[model samples]
Target: MQDHQSGHQRLTLSDVQRPEYLANPYPLYHRLREHDPIYWDEEMHAWVLTRYTDVVAVLRDPRFSSAWGPVETAWMPEELRPQLEPALRAVSRQMLFLDPPDHSRLRGLVARAFTPRMVESLRPRVQRLVDELLDAVQDQGEMEFVADFAYPLPAIVIAEMLGVPPEDRSQFIVWTQDFGRLLDGGHLSFEELLTTLSGIADFLAYFRRQIAQRRTAPRDDLLQALILAEEQGDRLNEEELLGNCVLLLAAGHGTTTHLLGNGLYALLQHPEQLQLLRENPSLAPTAVMELLRYDSPVQLTSRRLTADVEWAGRRFKAGEEVLTVLGAANHDPEQFPDPDRLDLRRTDNRHVAFGHGPHFCLGAPLARLEAEVAFTTILRRLPQLCLATEQIERLPSLVFRGIKALPVTFASVLPATGATAAAED
Candidate 1:
């Protein structure tokens, strides 16, 4: 509960993990944005940026590099270094952690497959998946939203997009959960680090098999597209290919899942906003944007300084780490008036929920389409939907914000005619 008013010098990232802050961190975010926009946490040894302008500046500035490998492992204990080396090596190549020419090259190749037209073409299928998912639980008066709907919708969509067999979809649910824990940038217990590494190993292995199969028998899916993607005779190398594929799968679904859960929970909490969305279905697009702004799934992203620079009157040295608190930035009062309030029709959002600049989420279009379809479909189908319990458990990672489980009750509704058949097709 340390705050600027309490004479605390600085608030550590660990402070946000307390039950109260974990459930709702906006209050803390407000305090940071207002009093300590540029804070240096002695524990994390990183400068924390909470103000909207500062966060956006760091994200767009090339001086703040995205290459996190050296920063992440520099202080690691020698004993745990070897244990995490393999995982670190794989992550270092992923586009998310690369900088400049490497990131630009990798992103360009992948962008070809994720064009807006490509994502739009999948709407029908995404809609069908949403219908089928809801139809399964429509008969029951209650269901776990995260397990039944939120997780599967995007997971299946991304898996299908990658041409993964339906049977293999279940495995990713487990793998991605483990991979997510590694993204938090917090100190991990030895056991936790080992578990994350195991998941990373398995995920890369699975993609390796897919890559091999696609090399011989190419299909008309993203995996095959990625395999064949070329630019000026430059193609993704073996490790880069596998690393980015794993990134696509993990990032593709994990954040979208949280968007659905967090967005829905936000709507439910603000019943007026929920009613507004339900009444005016056309507001789906704006409503989705507002939801993303209100409670971003990805709360924080880190960057290592490429060169010494003075920003916001503070001189930061080269190689220093900076953590941009996106959640806090999204709610900055200077940027979004009455920032804490949920307004579905709010405009000029320009929120960094999916991030900003080159490292902006490549899967953003697809995520938005999936959420638009989901929120619209949920409201249309489950008119009586209400939280089964007020007590909800949020995922532990500070990097990703999400509800671990969301049990809800609603009046049972039968499947729409042919909805089940269409989904199965």
Candidate 2:
């Protein structure tokens, strides 16, 4: 275990990558927030903001740009820069990486399909999927939570929404895993970069074919809606359409998978909280919110300063990069009372688990719905569920926090005759 305070008074980004920190980063975040709330990380070539106030301020500030084209290639090796062009181009068009008017334009076109009402309409389908997934392992008495339950629910939901063939849903796991690596604060090795780019290439190609098919024969799906979406004669171009579709697919499932894994792990650790939730399933909404605050799936987000500014007692120049530590902000003691404790009933919880301001997560409602359904159904169906092993592995990424796999045991229940029947009722 590395000492939280050793010789140096200030913590660096390398300290964040320590094995212990990766498993549980809140302690490290506490140290960072306490000692250097707005510190410059020499390794990352960016300012790291850990305080809740600072994170919220930066996120809502218009001066900080989300555009990635200028920021992505800044740290790349000169030789590899050319190799990264295609990947960068694809990312530049993504709503996640763009700022208005592009961000506004793209989001306006896609927001209709993800509105609260629209997402709520997905509850029945999500519930059915959750029940079916649990039904598959209900007889096993044990299962890997991530593979058995967490990953598939949202993945299948998003795939079906995009009109992706059911058979093609499995391939997204590989593509998303590869794409997620690129967001891990650029710690990729030479080989890893190539693999990520290849995976992205394949993802785009696959979607290109889908888009072409939608063009020829329209369907009543989100993808086709995007294809036909027009705002005052403005429409998504080929690159924008491809980039956003891939973004939706990856972002849709990846964060939710982590949320479920992290949320369940947190609950299992705090058995009292788990039991509290079990006794009062009505707490599902607040419980999910608390879980998000306790250990956010997307830990960090970056922004580029558009102009020189003095804030948080520091001067930031135009074009300087800033990394807002969302996970840390979510755990800030000032904002969240008993920040580390798992309280299913925590209220007025305005955690940035889905972010804030214009760039807040588009799929938040869908993710929350999926989680609410999954947690409620899992507790109801699987009696006496408990961790099968204390040993657990976390995904190797700083920006995204998640369990690689969670094995658990439960008293097996008889399989349901009809998974959707209860949902319909």
Candidate 3:
């Protein structure tokens, strides 16, 4: 509930959802951390948690269930559940929304198929994609960083990783944008809900068709490997397979794109941090970690109580919603000294940007790799890069924080690099 005390200002998450706050919500996060770390809000009908310790506790505790309630009505508005039964099940079965045994089962197979080895192998490919993306705008001297670099870099990586056809990558990008709304919108508006439904339907059809084809003619990709993940005479059901595939497609790309976009934007905003990284290339990894903490891509995640539990001197009943303000937690003073400052060399950082415990993002390593590669390449290659416009549009998403477009200009370094190279001469 909104606090309307006369002559005394107070705020809530809804206040943080506006355009002004979206652009810069860290201050509000700071306020939450200092004032109401475990606030009960009537509007959200959830315990709004802002402290690092509390957010981590909720995330790691087994008392909290990630499973969505009633699969049929989970994906869309209550009224639309009848028509979207199949689509709802597909979404509801995703490991992101499951708990314990089911979560462990799906995660085991995915972890096996998408190991750190696989991510390490993509380093060269990710670098090439970054180069190619930058090369496309090398002559223009200006480009929309989000559309040109950030979006395409991760989109291409995820597409190739999933065995999505080279030609079909464009459509896959469109589908991914639609799916991102499922998480980012909180509760979707009618039009947005319809778009999400349509996206899920298309994805279900495509995943099923692809799974069927892969069974007939297996490919050497993550999807194929997942389809083949057989354990103790067990395997993914059609529903599980479809759900996880769609989950991978949606999660695999969108978060990384936002990371790239938000990380870049954060650097631009704090030129000193950008300068530090540019001068010291070895700091790339730490810089990425700092960026994730500085301006996290995924800002909020939720959990439901499975049983009544007492936490932080408060009682929360079973099945109650707990809203973890990840962005706020990342900036909690208790967790990080000088929480507002952008320190690329931030060492004690344990930000919950990717959450924590069982449901932590599987693609965290890959996202980190992409950010490091992207940041390193951009700094090394485009030394003259600068923002073309001060106007940066944050994504219309509560969960995902990213710029709509980061217009930028840099000196064309193509001729020098090209002129220095002579093919077999």
Q: Give the per-residue lDDT digits (tens) of candidate 1, residues 313-389.
A: 78889989999999999999899999999999899899999999989999999999999989987887887889999
Ranking by TM-score: 2, 1, 3
| Per-residue lDDT of model 3, residues 181-211, tens digit only | 7766377777877877777878889887887
TM-score of 1: 0.92
- Stretches of candidate 3 exceeding 4 Å from the true structure: 1-10, 73-83, 230-233, 414-425
Candidate 2 residue pairs in backbone clash: none
Q: lDDT by residue for model 2 over 1-425, one digit each (tens)? A: 12234465547755667789877888988887887788888777888889999999999898999887553566556776665655667767899988888899899988998999999988888887877788788778999999888998888999999898867878999989887887777677877787787788788889889988877888899898887763224567766887888899999999999999999999899989989998999999999998999999998999999999999678999999999999999999999898988889999899999999999999999999898888877887888899999989887777888998999999885555464685667
How many Å off is the CA of 281 in candidate 2?
0.7
lDDT of each: 0.85, 0.85, 0.81
